[model samples]
Target chain A: MKKVKIYVTLRESVLDPQGSAVMGALHTMGYNEVADVRIGKYLELQVDDSERALDVIVKEMCEKLLTNTVIEDYRYDVEEAVSK
Target chain B: MKKVKIYVTLRESVLDPQGSAVMGALHTMGYNEVADVRIGKYLELQVDDSERALDVIVKEMCEKLLTNTVIEDYRYDVEEAVSK
Candidate 1:
């Protein structure tokens, strides 16, 4: 099987309040070294071996359901799963 | 500066309804090759150089705020950020 890892992040133009809140909390906790924070989504998908190009399928999924596209951007990495 | 990428995932024993729902939708959409799906959080943190060890600081952040040890597990990758 192949495992695909997807990362969906808000576009640079979008404001991320959650990330800002975390940054604030970090500062409050005395982690003064922290400069910025951005929060996003991570997803793992296990797919059976198929003839279709994995990248094509991944893109389809991201555009159709995995990401908003309007406000978010996505990237993916695929690796062969260690079969048990 | 260093860029830390943290991934927080639900423990295998924990139920992931959001992942299940996404899998169901994929199958319904005819992406039958998908066998499993897992959803998690991705975070990017930019930190200034410090005398303290990066791993130690990362662990502290993960334990104190980035993850819920009881139900979630977190791992992080640290890399030098591209200076712009």
Candidate 2:
């Protein structure tokens, strides 16, 4: 089995109000050492097989469905595992 | 300075066509042992200061702008580093 990990984040130009809030909280909580915080998402996937064609297929999926390429970006890690 | 790492990924129930494609590649690449692969996004943030109230601000930013909560989920890690 193959296990894949994907991460998504916003473009730098965009303002991150949410992160600002967290930074504010950390300061008030006495965790003043912390400077800023931004939140993203984690996606883990399991695939049936490994092949060169899969890369194209995956990229297409990301562009077409999985991600909003306009505002966010994506990356992934691949690993091998045995099926249960 | 504080650095925040955010991860964005799809829920397990969602179909990962992109991951399947990567798995196919590994198999064709002579790495037949590989089973699956999934892709996601990463977001790193640098905050101006660390404060207790920052947490709330950050969360709101993520909710309002950074991520698409419908199909994606997010999490973050916080650490302090000396500012240059």
Tens-place lDDT digits, model 2, residues B1-84: 566676666665766787687667556655564444555656566765634455775576567656689877777776775566
lDDT of 1 by residue, B1-84 (tens): 999999999998999999999999999998988999999999999999999888999899999988999999998999999988
Off by over 4 Å in 2: A50-52, B1-84
Q: In lDDT terms, which candidate is top?
A: 1
DockQ of each model vs. true complex: 0.87, 0.29
Candidate 1, which segments miss by more than 4 Å at Cα? none
Note the Cα lDDT for every prediction shown.
0.95, 0.62
lDDT of 2 by residue, A1-84 (tens): 566666666665766787678567656655555445555555565655645555664566557655688877777676764565
**Count of clashes, each model:** 0, 64
Candidate achieving the largest DockQ = 1
Error (Å) of candidate 1 at residue B77 is 0.9
Model 2 chain B: which ten-residue window has the lowest total lDDT?
Answer: B30-39
